[model samples]
Target: MTDQRWAGVRQRVEAAGAGPGSGEVFGAWGHKWVVEEPLTRGELAELEAQTGVRLPEEYRAFLLHVGAGGAGPAYGLFPVRRVRGRWRWEGDGADLADLSRLDQPFPDQGPPRKLLDDLLAQRPEEEDFDEIEDFDDAIEAWDERWEAVMFTPERTSGAIVISHLGCAQREWLIISGSHRGTVWSDCRVDDADLVPLLDDDAVPVRFDRWYTDWLEGAERTALSAP
Candidate 1:
């Protein structure tokens, strides 16, 4: 059944690659619509065993039937590779995922709304400071607090970063707990908390939908390129 669903995925990606302006898409230069080799069942098992968590089923099938990773949304999916006999994913900010804690439930909420708002409110404005050095010092202290709240490992437990959108933005695939199988947007770089990617109906987007939507859009962009 999974095989049936994933049928032609590689072909579709290839067809999209043939489009004249495909390279014009944001982050296309990184992957160039090139899908990597799929993983064997044994390799997949090894990865799961090493991580101590089963990957979302849809994404698992993708690694088996489509590609391990490549030519995805934004800059593209981070490719998982064997490094020095250990499996790990490679890409910008990929290290942000705490693989050792993949079994934990991804926190439903980040720091309290009031706390975030207070921190933002406290962000130093250069115009308010008589001395530039004072402004820099104030902003630096505020940033440390903000980072402590936003970038902690507990915030993203059970998630694997799947793609980097550049500028410190990325997407996550939830691998455990209630939200497992959903794709989430990471916009903490822009001072927003991680949120689930939503479909047109406002439902959370799953791994398969996220990839296929990007693939379809990429194909359209490619085919329409002049």
Candidate 2:
């Protein structure tokens, strides 16, 4: 019922994705294409629903391309890789393709914790999309002035990278992984307003990372971190 707006589109995507081993699918703009197989319609719907915000129309169009052209180096959209099993790209500095993949084996070694540090150190010869990093740093710097928590855009629909500051360190909350865009933010509101939207039995839960992962999706996840 929640997916009624995109039911026709979703049906088409689910039909196409019905294979034996599809692992993931990328959807945005108006086009839905399978990224990996073996995934189910329910799972994909959950992924779409997780973000709260819907994907942008233009973005879905690009997603229909589905890495068909290899996510070119100039468009700044082609340089995506998985982070912590989630797809992310900061697109403002250094070659990030090798750094974006999260499922690569650590084996007996260790996680590439230094990957960000390393990327920061290198100088990419291409057009600098590193401005996205500058934006992230700005978000981190400005998050200390709030109380309770604040989402970049509080309670609404459409594409937005929500930034919720609960503690000192910031968390990135992403609603959906497709649109890769950010919304604005709003100050504190009474819980009574939000409570009405909740089901009777649904316990209030915390959403630090999911509220802030827009940067991972839209390159502005840390916009509200302290």
Candidate 3:
């Protein structure tokens, strides 16, 4: 079933690559529509064994059929690779994922809304300070508090950072718990909490839908380029 959904994905990606203005897509230069080689079943099994958690089925299928990672949404999907006999995803901010804790459940809620609001309210503004050095010092202190709330390892258990969207933004794939298989947008850089990526109908998008939507959109953009 998964194979059927991903059939010819490589061909489609190649076709998009050949389209006019394909390079205009954000992060196009990084992947150039090149899907990395798919992972073998044994390799996949080994990765799972090492991580101690089975990847979401759709993502597992993607790794098996479509490609381990490449030419994906944003600046391309971060590819997982074996290094020093251990499998790890390589990309900007990819290490943010605590692979050792993937078996844990992703928390249903992040820091409380009121807490986030308080933190934002406390953020320092350069214009508020007369001296630039004072502003920098104040902002540095505020940033430490902000990172403490936002960048904690527990904030994203059971998730993997999948794609980087530049400017400190990235996407996450949930691997365990109730939200398993869903793709989420991380906008913490913009002082927003991690939230589910919604579709046109405002539905939480799963891995297959997320990837396929991006592929189809890219194809349309390529074909329409004049």
Task: List TM-score per model, in order.
Answer: 0.97, 0.22, 0.96
Q: Which is better, 2 or 3, measured by TM-score?
A: 3
Could you give candidate 1's per-residue lDDT for residues 146-194 as a string of tens digits? 9999999999999999998888989999999899999999999988989
Q: Which segments of model 1 are wrong by more than 4 Å?
A: none
lDDT of 3 by residue, 39-120 (tens): 9999999999999999998899899998889899988999999999999999999999999999999999998889999999
Instruction: Order candidates by TM-score, high to low.
Output: 1, 3, 2
Candidate 1 backbone clash number: 0
Error of 2 at 187 (Å): 27
Give each model's whole-structure lDDT. Answer: 0.91, 0.28, 0.92
Error of 2 at 73 (Å): 7.7
The regions of model 2 sitting more than 4 angstroms off are: 1-47, 68-75, 78-81, 93-226
In order of lDDT, best first, we have 3, 1, 2
Among all windows of 10 consecutive residues in model 2, the one with the lowest summed lDDT is 190-199
